[model samples]
Target: MKFVIHDRNNAIKVIDSDKDQDSVVKGRFVQDVLYELASKNSMEFIGWCHKDLEDFINHDQLNSIFHHELIMASYSTTGDYEIPEAIGYIENSTTFLNVKPDVNYPTWLMSSDIGGMHAMVILKFENLKGSTKTSFDGFLNHISKTALSEGLFCYSSPGLLKKDSVSIESRQNKINLFYFVRHHYRSRWLPLLFLDYLLYEK
Candidate 1:
């Protein structure tokens, strides 16, 4: 099978086979396409690789460049308003699992309740500049047609109001937390104080 994801003027085609042996190839193709999209847009693509997820969660040096708070927020908000039908679609169809982040670009995966083996994509307009709910809906409609042509299922939830804006002020506030600890904690009890602040304040 083959699927194409259309993003504005750009379209990405991903090829896969129905055979089980070709599953690995299909997975790699999907990853490559997703990575290309992310790179082209100056974003980051984090897939379902266990090591990658562990490294991202544990603050491993390999993926240390990503903001910890931003990642946590993404995880927390991804399934905030999931559609009930999405679980059925995911279980009965082939749905991709991945995290695509570009500073403020709001794209998240809504996993199924059945062991989270499948997920649907949820996109928000607030993360998109100069975009409205209508434009976003149109984009999804276009992609759904392409997905249908390739014998695949593509689902997205309705666009909702922007809740978390990752504006400059928010970024600065997160940065200032580290700076405050660095400048104020200078004594032997500094580690304790910092730990307390992280546990209580954060």
Candidate 2:
């Protein structure tokens, strides 16, 4: 992959053939400037409206960051209910939440990815009989309700819902959903119907 770096005046330019396609040249540079500026100014760098990191990121990068935040923020709500673990890791970093979360954890939501609004939640059904159903109907109902009521949506993968999870444990179960939200950027992966519901409700 070829990469180009240009100075503010367009007088200085550097090229790199080794830079990856997803690499962020402008973002890294902007981040450095924001950090120095914030340090000197004594304020938050990434979240600042005047110099928000959102302004510096491209769509693809923003999407990756959004996904990262969704996982992180959704992490906080995991195992919140009676379940032992609401979300479980699949690959080392990739996780599986039972249902969707109320919030999306964005990389830029807070100072660092780890410190940001990483939330996870488990929903437990009480005094329930029969196996906890996680079929299409149940999943749709839960996701729709959340989206309609809270302006949240189930993140989407290419062919299926973005939720990562497993079957319920006994009559006691946790509905796991993983999500993250950032203040500025919106992901197309979000539940569009929910967004419509929110707009209409308001």
Clashes of each: 0, 23
Q: How far is candidate 2 from the true structure (C-alpha RMSD, Å)?
A: 20.1
Compose the digit string of candidate 1's lDDT tens values, residues 1-202. 1222222223233322222221222322322333443344333322222211221222222133232212311222243222222222213343334434223232222211100001122122123323332222232323233334444332221111123322111111223333333433345444555565566655
The CA lDDT at 8 in model 1 is: 22
In candidate 1, stretches whose alpha carbon ends up further than 4 angstroms from where it belongs are: 1-57, 61-81, 86-91, 94-128, 134-202
Reference-based lDDT, each prediction: 0.27, 0.25
lDDT computed for candidate 2: 0.25
TM-score of each: 0.18, 0.18
Model 2 TM-score, all chains together: 0.18
Q: Please report the candidate that would top lDDT against the real structure.
A: 1
Tens digit per residue, CA lDDT, model 2, 1-202: 1112223111122222233332333433322332333344342112111111212223232234334422211122122322212222111223333444434422111111011111221111111112233321222223223332343323322111123322222222322222321111255424552454356535
